[model samples]
Target chain A: MAQRTPLFEQHQAAGARIVDFAGWEMPVRYGSQIDEHHAVRRDAGMFDVSHMTVVDLAGDRVREYLQYLLANDVGRLRTAGKALYTCMLNEDGGVIDDLIVYFLDDTHYRVVVNAATRDKDLAWIGEHAKVFGVGVTERDDLAMIAVQGPQARERAVGCLPPAIADAARDLKPFSAAAHGEVFVGRTGYTGEDGFEIILPGDDAPALWQALSAAGVTPCGLGARDTLRLEAGLNLYGQDMDESTSPLESGLGWTIAWEPVDRDFIGRQALEQQKADGAPYRFTGLLLEGRGVLRAHQTVITVDGEEGEITSGTFSPTLERSIALARVPVGTGERCEVEIRGRRLPVRCVRPPFVRNGEIKINLD
Target chain B: MSDIPGDLRYTKSHEWVRQDDDDRVTVGITDHAQGALGELVYVELPEVGMELSAGDACAVVESVKAASDVYAPLEGVVVEVNDALADRPELVNEQPYDDGWIMRLEQVDEDELAGLLDADTYLETLEDE
Candidate 1:
């Protein structure tokens, strides 16, 4: 059976373009996708990201279990309401899922995992929690809404209860705070300043509607992908998977190597990969010619090494084709992409074609 | 908008062709095709002076969500392609009938053109679907 979010009826009221994504019914777009994309970049926009799974871990050993489970050190989240972004890996160093773990208290921590990877992530965390005595409870009663942009916080903070507005207003990036029963986190995937508000599932529709009335454009998954790609964020299935490791997937920085003695899942495999050095690196591409770069297209390197484009699109902000590809580590600034048997030249740069409403790579 | 134009002929694959005064023909995807695709982002057209046979793949229209092929209505030499498409692919979505015509054929068989559907017939086929 297809699952519906708390805002399902509200989406129907707005004439949204609906599609089935990962076995869940989702809105692909409300109206013009480009308009929503720009709204988040310039003004404010809201997204119904309630389909993502939220798990709350509670007990005496909760922090200890996360330290053992995540690749990034969770000890850095010393203060309450601090959020940490990290990847949980399997025994072979392949990423299980990249997620955000928030420490609400010493005994209460919240972890939000990808909707598609929820089952595996829960089992992995459960396995580690067995020894630590941590209780992992899925928060099905909660639904999340992300209001993101320069004005996102202003609009969303006003819609919530008065108690939350104060603390939520002061939330630093990568932080979360609870006021009453609402959990407002200063985090977002759109590379814009915003909040991900977690509230009771029954109250989500009313809140989503309130924000709609406030002139914050309601965006969908289509705009979300473009926004995250423009911000240089990696999608799990395309950018990395179980067979791929953090070192080669441009996620090495997310791995905490400090203290060197810390043994997280897949640390041994990552150490071996580090000693071997990276043979190929993930890169960003800007098409010099006319054509949209798309996934699975072959990227031609000067050294004749084959690289595959993981994610590509015609960037609305840049008005040119941009893509992320895994190429030979030495593959430098210039390359060609095969589009319909024609090898079109492109410029390769560091990952992330755009950031914070600014074009990171020069097109002209 | 009117189902199909009376003066033009249509292929079963949804291409519309108009015969010119000099035996040349202008071929383009039907308006229905563009509306279904929704927001074209890229176009891959066949080269000028390329030989094509009837029902041969002539061009590719790529929307953001999917890609579709354009087939030749009649066999001929490709005299020219819509060069504007290379820079402005969304023209296919915005102006699919006129400026968005995919290609022009230098020589086309009249017999092949005669077998295609007339305006009324094409509109009836659309209504059935």
Candidate 2:
């Protein structure tokens, strides 16, 4: 049996197609997935992301512990409610998981991690915190909802209480605010302005109804995947895993190498890789032909060197197929993708095919 | 509930078949098939004059989530393919029976059409699944 989120009943009422995802029964789509994808790009749409694991760290040494545990520098998050996106790496420089850490205060911090990696992430954090005397508490009692789009903030404010709404209105991107039991963060996976709200599980259904009434479409994981892919965001367990390092996963910018003394877990291995030229290159691919791009497809360069697609999908915003590929360090502007035994030409571009409800890439 | 036309024959794989007066047979995915697959973004059809056997995978329909293979209902030679679907694959989702017909088959086995399930039988097959 799979676990159900607090919003499962609401999903059923809205005629969603439920599927098992990472041991949880989750909604994949309500009706037309393309329509749901467009909803987030053009207007407000909400997704129940309650399945993600939320853990709170508390202690006098919380910041120090996180600095040693994560690859990115959490010390940069100076203000309260400021959030930082970072990757937790194993000692061998392999990515354990990618997460967002929120600095609530000196003694309190929150981290949200992927659902599939919950067990390992919690165990790893617990083992490391023992030396720092920090307390790790998993917040299973909470539910999360992300409302995203160009009009997302305006419509989402209509459903929140007055104080949180007011604070949320002025919240900067990558910042969060709390009111009573609800926590609102101006962050999202889709490349648009939005809020991610975390509240008590019991209060989820009513809030979902209110948001739906405010004309925020109830989207599902299908739309979420497409939207994030179009935004050039990475999905854990697909694009990277414990076998891959951040240096080759298009996440090198997240690593903090300054303050030579900051001995994060993967520092030695990462420094060694950086000293040598990184062997792999991560880039984006735009299909120049009619077929749809899919993961694991072989990409052959003009020199006959090979690469593979890490993530691929049909971009609802662009109405064309696109992908992210890991190729040799010098793979150039043009390559051919083998789809159905035919080699079709593809153009390489910097990612983020669409953003803020507009096409960011030149199709021509 | 899906729309299963009473006049057509259906395969267990969810394709509908119709026999024309010229002894040719037209085939397309059923309404239930299109609804389950969601909005199709691309369709790959076998070319005209291609030979197919009963139960052969003749076409491919790709939705945003995944791709599904459309099986041939009866053995025949492809006489014509729906060229409009190359640009507008959503036609299969909007009208799976009429404008969405994927291909017309010539040299079809008439006995094979009789073996397919009727509307009532096809609905029962769906219910069992």
Candidate 3:
């Protein structure tokens, strides 16, 4: 039996197509996935992302524990409600999970991790947290909803409690604030301005309804995947997993290398790998012709270096196929992707194919 | 539940067949098939002159979720492929029976048409699935 979120009933009520995803019964789409994708790009759309795990950490050493456990430094969080995106790593420098940590106070913090990696992420964090005596509490009683698009903030804010709404409206990007039990973070996977709200599970349905009434379209995982792909966000299991390092997954910028003396998990291996020169470069591929690019497809660069696509989808925003790939270092501007036994030409470019309803990359 | 025209034929694979006249037949996926596929992004049609056997993987219909092969319900030489689908693949989702028709086949044996399921039988197969 798969687990269901608090919003499962609401999903069914909306005539969504339900599917099993990572041990949970989740909505894949309400109607046309392309329409949902366009709603997020052009207007406001909300997703029931309650499957994500929310963990609260409390202890005098909580900050220090996060600083050591994650690849990105939490020391950069200078204010309450400030959030930092970081990757938890094994000693071998391979990514365990990527998460966002929000500082609430010196002794209390919150982290949201991927739903698929819930068990291992909790176990890994728990095992390592013992040394620092941090109290790791999983907040399964909470539900998260991401409301996104150009008009997302405006429409979603109207549905929140007045005080929480006012505070959330003032939040800058990558910051969060809590009012009573409701937590609002001005961050999202879609490359659009929006809010990720975490509240008590029981309140989810009403809020979901309110948001819908407020003109925020109810979306699902199918639209979420495409929106995130277009935004150049990495899906943990597909883009990088326990076997891959952040350096080779276009996450070098997420690594905090400063404070040379700080010995975070995977520091030594990552430094060694950095010194040895990372062999693979993460890149984005745009198909020059018809046909969709899919994962595990072989990519052959002009120099004949073989690589593979990590994640691929047809961009509803761009009206073309795009993908994230791991190719050899120095792979140039052009390559060929083997789709259905045919090597079709593709252009190598940076990701973020679309942002804020605007095209970001050079389509020409 | 999807529309099953009483006059046409169906395969377990969810393709609908319409006998055009003497020996030719027009083929397209069923409404249930298109609904399962969601909105299509691209349609890979077979070449007009391609030869196929029954159950041969013929054309491809790609949605945002996954790509599915449209199989041949009978052995025949391809006579025409839907060109409108090249620009407007959503036609399959909008009109799986009419304008969304994928291909036409010539040289099809009349026996194969008799073997295909009619509306009532195809609806039963969908229920079993």
TM-score of each: 0.92, 0.97, 0.98
Q: Give the TM-score of candidate 3.
A: 0.98
Q: List the residue pairs that clash in candidate 2.
A: none
**What are the per-residue Cα lDDT tens digits for candidate 3 across A175-242?**
99899999999999999999999999999999999999999999989999999999999999889998
**Residue ranges of candidate 3 with Cα displaced over 4 Å:** none
Specify the CAPRI tier of model 2: medium
- lDDT per residue as tens, model 2, A1-364: 8999999999999999998999999999998898899899889999999999999999999999999999999899999999999999998899999999999999999999999999999999999999999999999999999999989999999899887889999999999999877999999999989999999999999999999999999999999999998998889998888988998889998999877889999989888888997888888899987878888999999889999999898888888899988888889999999987789899988878888888889898
Give the poorly placed runs of model 1, Cα more than 4 Å off.
B1-15, B18-24, B109-129
Residue A353 in candidate 3, Cα distance off native in Å? 0.8
Candidate 2 residue-wise lDDT, B18-111, digit = tens: 9984558999999999998888999999989999999999899998888899999999999999999999999999999999999999998778
Write the residue-wise lDDT of candidate 3 on B1-129 in tens digits. Answer: 689999999999999999997789999999999998899999999998999999999999999878899999998999999999989999999999999999999999999899999999999999998
Candidate 3 lDDT score at position A23: 90
- Tell me the DockQ of each model, to 2 decimals: 0.43, 0.77, 0.86
Where is model 2 more than 4 Å wrong at Cα?
A: B21-23
Give the candidate order by descending lDDT: 3, 2, 1
**Number of clashes in every candidate structure?**
0, 0, 0
True contacts kept of each: 0.27, 0.67, 0.87
